[model samples]
Target: MLRLILIGLLLLVIFPVLASAAKVMSADNSHWSTARRDSTGIAPDPKTTPEAVVQVYAARAFNWRGIFGVHSWIAVKPEKAESFTRYEVEGWGVSSGRESVRIGSYRPPDAYWFGNYPELLVDIRGAEAAALIPQIAAAANSYPYRDRYTIWPGPNSNSFVAHVARNVPGLRLDLPPTAIGKDYRTDGIFGVAPSNTGLQLSLFGLAGVTLALEEGVEVNLLGLTVGIDILTPAIKLPGIGRIGFPQGPS
Candidate 1:
């Protein structure tokens, strides 16, 4: 009986230490994976796979009165790193498709229009793509929706700020929780004729609690400005999309 008790006590002490050691080892492994292998923790090289290049675009118009207005786009690439490794393409076009998506009681069919007319072109390397996708998705779902809402807001702004900081944990900064009472809406659209052509990224669905980090890169383009943000880490979006750290790199 005494021997049994001794062994029990030993396990009680050793088990926690063993568990802690395992956690530490895991953390170290995760760190190495991200730093050395890949920039966004998704795929080391997105351009390496031709399929990695994804194009997202949409367009919509509404009519309120006699006036007919149109908004469209060319393309904008979503990125999580400084450069794209896997994909490069120079394409230009605009999208215009009218639909009745009511914003208020008065549903305009053609007069009211919102879309992007992008002509500038960008190259998305593999590392950059891994980091860019999630931020764009998050921005698409973010709060304080303007005429339309976006996650990264395309490759335009120098910085991407989340109104609800909880949505992106990889940013590695503190963000206050969003207020409870506010009305928010979002729409993603693209025009038919583009002034410039660059890589364009759009979200198809609300993302899960995926692991990611926000990275900003300075950019200059002829007759246009190119700003890029990369999202990092391979993460699974659990029930609540708000950001939090789990064990391991992602």
Candidate 2:
């Protein structure tokens, strides 16, 4: 499985440019220039922080990509720690041989993605987070594709968090449908859902299906996934994300 993933990554590296462009794009590249990436004050400031905490966030990727896909990351603060340590894979510098999978790379556990606000997918605080912080870190450190990055069918940001969730199912993280690259994996195509309650099968991240108590049923076609979250009673469309209920709470 590792060999297969390496081959795919090699293909992406060799083919720096695709023959055809992605069907849809984000609003514009300028969003990254003008949009804010600061802390949203959702996670407690680690300076006077008291207990451990773990949070997972997903937001529309910058630009037209935001209209169809999302980026995801994990943040964990050990008990009595001063600040939160974030883990995510980014594609910004891989072409230059820089490591894309970053641990504690950036902060503000709930920071905005470009100009988009994130939806907290999982929250475990206090004692629970204390217990899980080590395991989460281990998984982040253990990610094999530390230097690989592919915008499509990827080891992109979504895939990184999904890998951690698979490694630590206790998080029970359910990435949104718009997390287009979550299906990509370093292991193999077949694995248990991160929730540990369902089955998932993929084909080099391009095509697959997932069914779980938390994720419901999803079908991936050329990296574009469509599914329904029966538990939430929502529909997961190709580009619109979930429709039916306002996510998170007031």
* lDDT leader: 2
TM-score winner among the candidates?
A: 2
TM-scores of all predicted structures = 0.20, 0.84
Off by over 4 Å in 1: 1-51, 54-120, 146-250
**Which run of 10 residues does model 1 get worst, by summed lDDT?**
176-185
| Position 90, candidate 2: lDDT | 88
lDDT of 1 by residue, 1-250 (tens): 9999888545443443354345334432322223221121232233344432222211111121001111221112234322332211101111232221111212111111222121112223345544654553544344332223222222211111222222333323211111001001122322110111111122321111111233122121111112223332222111111133321122
In model 2, pairs of residues that clash are: 25-64, 26-63, 26-64, 26-65, 27-63, 27-64
Candidate 2 deviant stretches above 4 angstroms? 1-31, 246-250
Task: Please give, for residues 1-250, the per-residue lDDT of candidate 2 as tens digits.
Answer: 9999888644432222121124335234454777778988787777777888898899878876665578999888888777788889889888899999877746577888887778888888888888888888888888888878887878788888888988887888878877878889767989887666798999978999999998889888778767788877887666666777654422
